[model samples]
Target: MSAVRRLAGFICLLALLAGAVLWITRESARPRESYQEIGLRWLRDEYRLDDATFEKVAALHHAYFATCSQMCRQIKEATRPLLMQTRRQPLSTSTKAGLRQQEQKLCDDCELAAKKHLLQVADLMPEEQRQRFLDDMLSTLETQRLQHDLDMSAHTRR
Candidate 1:
């Protein structure tokens, strides 16, 4: 009877250990968000959006990124020739001026695209939230643009 009792106790301990291992594996397997995803998560949580609204907003967000990415590629392509020239010789004054103007126009176009997307998102927001959201987002966008300009100018001076 004592041996039987000992055998049952050992079996119970094994069962508990197996359960613990399974629990740890499941917990550790939970997926983590990448840095980029955290911004989207913040937008959802900060705006207190419902699932349906969030879905629409996320769709718009992704579309804007796609447009913005193309603008970035255009800027890169526009500069490629100048980059190649700079590697071999200094750029002519007119060439530098033309490239700078082209870059500015691309940046302006990208900004306009961003603003239009922001307005669309604001339109979908609740009436009470719409103005506030626009105000916050536009202000944030302007802040980022200003910082980017500052950084670029500083780099140029260097």
Candidate 2:
């Protein structure tokens, strides 16, 4: 009787352990939401947006982000050659200047696109929330842009 009880308890323990491991594995594999989604949710909650408005906002948000992501990839690709060039040998002053100019152009274009997207998103928000949203976003964007500019300038100098 004791052996039978011990065997039953052992089997149950193994079953429980297996179930836990499976659950953990499944959870680890689950997809996570992007920061864009989190921003959309914040807009909905903070702006007190209706479902219909939220749907429009979400569509615009996603479309803008898709384009934004593509541009980011392009920027990364553009920088790769510059990075490789520097790693292999020192560049001539003019060559370095040209590469830096190309990078600056890409960064400027991205900033413009982001500003345009912010304007479009603000247009969809409530009248009261529109300026506030822009203020919050543009201020944050400006700060980040300035910081990035500073970092790039410092990087180039070094």
Task: Name every residue pair that clashes in candidate 2.
Answer: none
Give one digit per residue, the lDDT tens place, for model 1 in 1-158. 69999999999999999999999999999998865468678877877777988888889988877787899899778655555564347677788678868877887888899899999988777787788889999999999889856755554332
TM-score of each: 0.68, 0.82
Cα shift from native, residue 17, model 2 (Å): 0.7
State the lDDT of candidate 2 residue by residue for 1-158, as single tens digits.
Answer: 69999999999999999999999999999998889889889889998888988999899988988889988897777665556555447677787788788877888899999999889988888899899889999999999889977866665554
Q: Which of the numbered candidates is closest to the native, going by highest lDDT?
A: 2
**lDDT of candidates 1 onward, in order:** 0.79, 0.85
Predictions: Cα RMSD each = 5.9, 2.5
